[model samples]
Target: MASRTTQILEAAARLVARRGVRGLRVEELATEAGVSTGLIYYHFKDRTGILRHTLEFINDRAERYTTSHMADAAPLAPRAELEEVLLLELQDAPEVRENSAAWGELRASAVFDEVLREDLARATLVWAQEVAALLGRVTPMAPAPALAAAGERLTALLEGLSMRWLSGGLELGHARDLLLGAIDAELARLQGK
Candidate 1:
């Protein structure tokens, strides 16, 4: 069974995703979780605690999902490897999509909440590091600086694709093609060096 804290966090995340964080209330989250409002306070000291826990939970799941997808693949060329990883990242895991929406709502609310902003920045750094590691493994020919630059570019592309997909700005197929093409072009440029 899920712990009370986990249940509360999941409930809060769903509520925040559907209706901005500003609309989230402790009583509502507790009710959604099928617990008493006092139970929430028992698990979390306050609203900020709940939000922080939810962000950490989302980040942990993302790391696990990305790592699992990248592990145990057959060795391939840098271009092929990059394409594979991009495809995996671009495909929206339902859990991730919901968590991402919740995070987006938190991000907008974070403009006025320093704690939320800091939590988000920390989570972003963890994600960027994971992306950098994946890029580094593929770009062995490139120097550290060059590989790092590529990683940053790849991160940007992934983020952009995610935002576009979530906002219904682009179809998944189009985004995949665009990302694959960009990765292939970059790999070719590296190969020529």
Candidate 2:
């Protein structure tokens, strides 16, 4: 039940994920979404508009997905919430895998594109803040340096491990274990244990 804009965004995301942004063409995107090139321009204005909207579309989807999952598990303990949030990153479903790959592609593309760089940095910052809040809630310390450092560490581990997972180098269960282990170790360090 997605709208036309969502349909176009999804198509564009798949194309970008598969071939990178440099490979995206209006005709190809139109054909992929079963819309005319005019419709694409009408919805997004131009190539840059389409690209910006596509990135925002993907970011919004991630935020919604994370929010939904976190909300569903809100009754759980702080550690469980932390586990749910981080483990949600490694989804085995086809759509999730596509999005994960697309995310990696977008992150890579952002290095050379200033606009994308800003957007991607904003997305990462939001996610990191969420992780920091979770770390603060789960750890013995307050939302101070301990939580900030632990959250950053967890975010780095998630990004690195997500790359490995997306490349088929790690399974979801293994990634979950590794994340939990890291979280536990980080908590221990925070507690001076």
Candidate 3:
């Protein structure tokens, strides 16, 4: 069973996924979490506090998910392992989809809310660096600058594709195909093939 704090954060993530940050209300969150507002405040202080913690919670979960998946993928080739990590955002599982939506909500809201920008940027940078590391593993001879550029491009594409998929603007299969195609193309270019 999840602790009260994790329960509240998970509820917050679900609300954020469905309604975005602007739609998240403490009372509704409390109700969804099956806890009192007092408990919510005790755990997180206020709505902003909740939002901040929720973002961190989501990022932390995503990192752990990727790490675990990558660990299980040790027998796979580097490119396959990279594909697994990149496709995580598009996974059909309910929790993965909800987390992707919540993260997307935070990323979109960060533009108008300066408080979220730093944390979102930090999360994005961490993801991009991970992508770069995977790219380095895939092509050890690639220059650092080139690997970083590829990472940034891939992450940017991922964000765009994920938003589209979440909004129903793109199909799941197409999103996966596009991402896999981009990965192949990027690796080919890196390899000078």
Candidate 4:
């Protein structure tokens, strides 16, 4: 069975994604999870604690998914490898999309919450580092700084695309195609240099 803390976090994430973090209520989360309000407090000290853990949970899953998806592409050319990574990042797995919604809520909350702001910064750094590692494997011509910058750019692009798709600005299929095409073009340009 999932631990109580895990259950609470998962429920809270779903609620936050659906209702926004500010709109989340402990009572609602507890009821959704089939637990009591005190159980939420037992696992998390308060609302902030729940939100922080929820963000961490989502980020952890994303990191794992990205890392695992890229694991087998190590031997491919840099451009191909980067394209594959971008494709994986752009493809919206249902769980990932839901988690991303939660992430968006957390990002908005970060504007007012110091803890969430710090968490967002940390998550961004982690994503940048992951992107840099993938880029380094493919783009041998660039210095580390340039490669890291490219990684940050790609990360930002994907994040923006995700937000747009989640908010119904673009269809999922179109967003994926656009992001993949952009990534492919960028990689080709990098490789041609």
Candidate 5:
């Protein structure tokens, strides 16, 4: 059986995705988690506490999701490996889309929330570092500084494309293509092509 804390966090993620972060209520969360409100408060001090764990929970899930995709691409070429990561990151299936959208909403909400802002900044850097390490594998010609910049750029591109794709401004394929294309182009440029 899932722990009560895990159950609460899972329900909180669904609630946050369905109804933005600020819309969650202790009563509703308790009902969804099938636990008493007091139990939730016991596990998490308050609403923000729940939200904090929920954010970490969602991020951890996403990283695991991305890692699953990365695992199979180990034997592929560097570019193909990078594409694997980007494709998973840009996946458009309902579950991935909803998770991405929820995270995006939280990112936006962080603008007005200091603690959340700090958490998001840290979470985002973890992702950026992951991409940078991926880029490091592919961009042999680029210096460390250049690779770092490229990684930051790639992360920005992913974020921009993801937000647009989530908003219906772009299709998932388009987002994936754009990201993969940028990766290829960056590698070529770094190779002095």
Candidate 6:
């Protein structure tokens, strides 16, 4: 069984995804998790606490999943590692989709909520750094600045495409294709091809 903390975090993700951050209520979250409101408070402190923790939890989960997957596919080329990290969130699994949805919500809400901006920015940069590191591995000869720029571009495109996909504004196949194309183009540019 999932630990109570994990259960609460999962419920928080679901609630955040279904209702925007502003709409998430403690009572609703408790009911969703089959836990008391006090448990939620004990674990997270408050709504802002819940939002912060959920954001971290979802991002951590994604990172862990990508790491495990890459480990399983050991001996993969740098390009393959980069591709997996970028595309893993697009998987059709229920958990991936839910996490993506909640992530999108938290990201969108951060613009208006000061409490979430710092954590959101931190998470965003962490993802970009992961992409940057992978890009550096793939293009060992490329200058650091160039690799960083490419990583930023790719990460930005992935996040934008994901948000659009979640909103039904873009098809899954198209989003995946666009991301892949962007990755290819960026790498080609970095490689001076």
Identify the candidate with maximal lDDT: 3
- Root mean square deviation (Cα) for candidate 4: 2.5
lDDT of 4 by residue, 52-127 (tens): 8887787676666666765564777766766666666455676667767877776677788776666578778877
Would you list the C-alpha lDDT of every candidate in the order shown?
Answer: 0.71, 0.81, 0.86, 0.76, 0.79, 0.82
Please, what are the lDDT tens digits per residue for candidate 5 over residues 62-178? 666655665564688877676777676688577777787778877787788776766677667777777777887887667877777777888888888989987789988778879
Instruction: Give the distance in Å from residue 142's predicted Cα in candidate 3 to where it truly belongs.
Output: 1.4
Please list all clashing residue pairs in model 3, or write none if there are none: none
lDDT (tens digit, per residue) of candidate 3 on 32-150: 99988889888876788999888778777766666566556478788878898899788889887888898888787778778777767877887888899999899999998889999
What are the RMSD figures for all models against the true structure? 3.1, 2.5, 2.0, 2.5, 2.5, 2.6
lDDT of 6 by residue, 56-175 (tens): 776677556545654565687889878978898777778778878887887777777787677667667767777888999998899988988888899888879989998889999889
Ranking by lDDT: 3, 6, 2, 5, 4, 1
- Model 5: runs farther than 4 Å from truth? 36-38, 63-73
Clashes of each: 0, 0, 0, 1, 0, 0
TM-score to native of every candidate shown: 0.76, 0.83, 0.88, 0.83, 0.83, 0.83
User: How far is 144's C-alpha from truth in model 4 (Å)?
Assistant: 1.6
> Could you say which candidate leads in TM-score?
3
Q: Whole-model lDDT, candidate 5?
A: 0.79
**Cα deviation of 27 in candidate 1 (Å)?**
3.9
In model 2, pairs of residues that clash are none
Off by over 4 Å in 4: 68-80
TM-score of 1: 0.76
Candidate 6 residue pairs in clash (backbone atoms < 3 Å):
none
- The local distance difference test score of model 1 is 0.71
Alpha carbon lDDT at 156, candidate 1: 73
lDDT of 6: 0.82
Q: CA lDDT of 136 in candidate 1?
A: 63
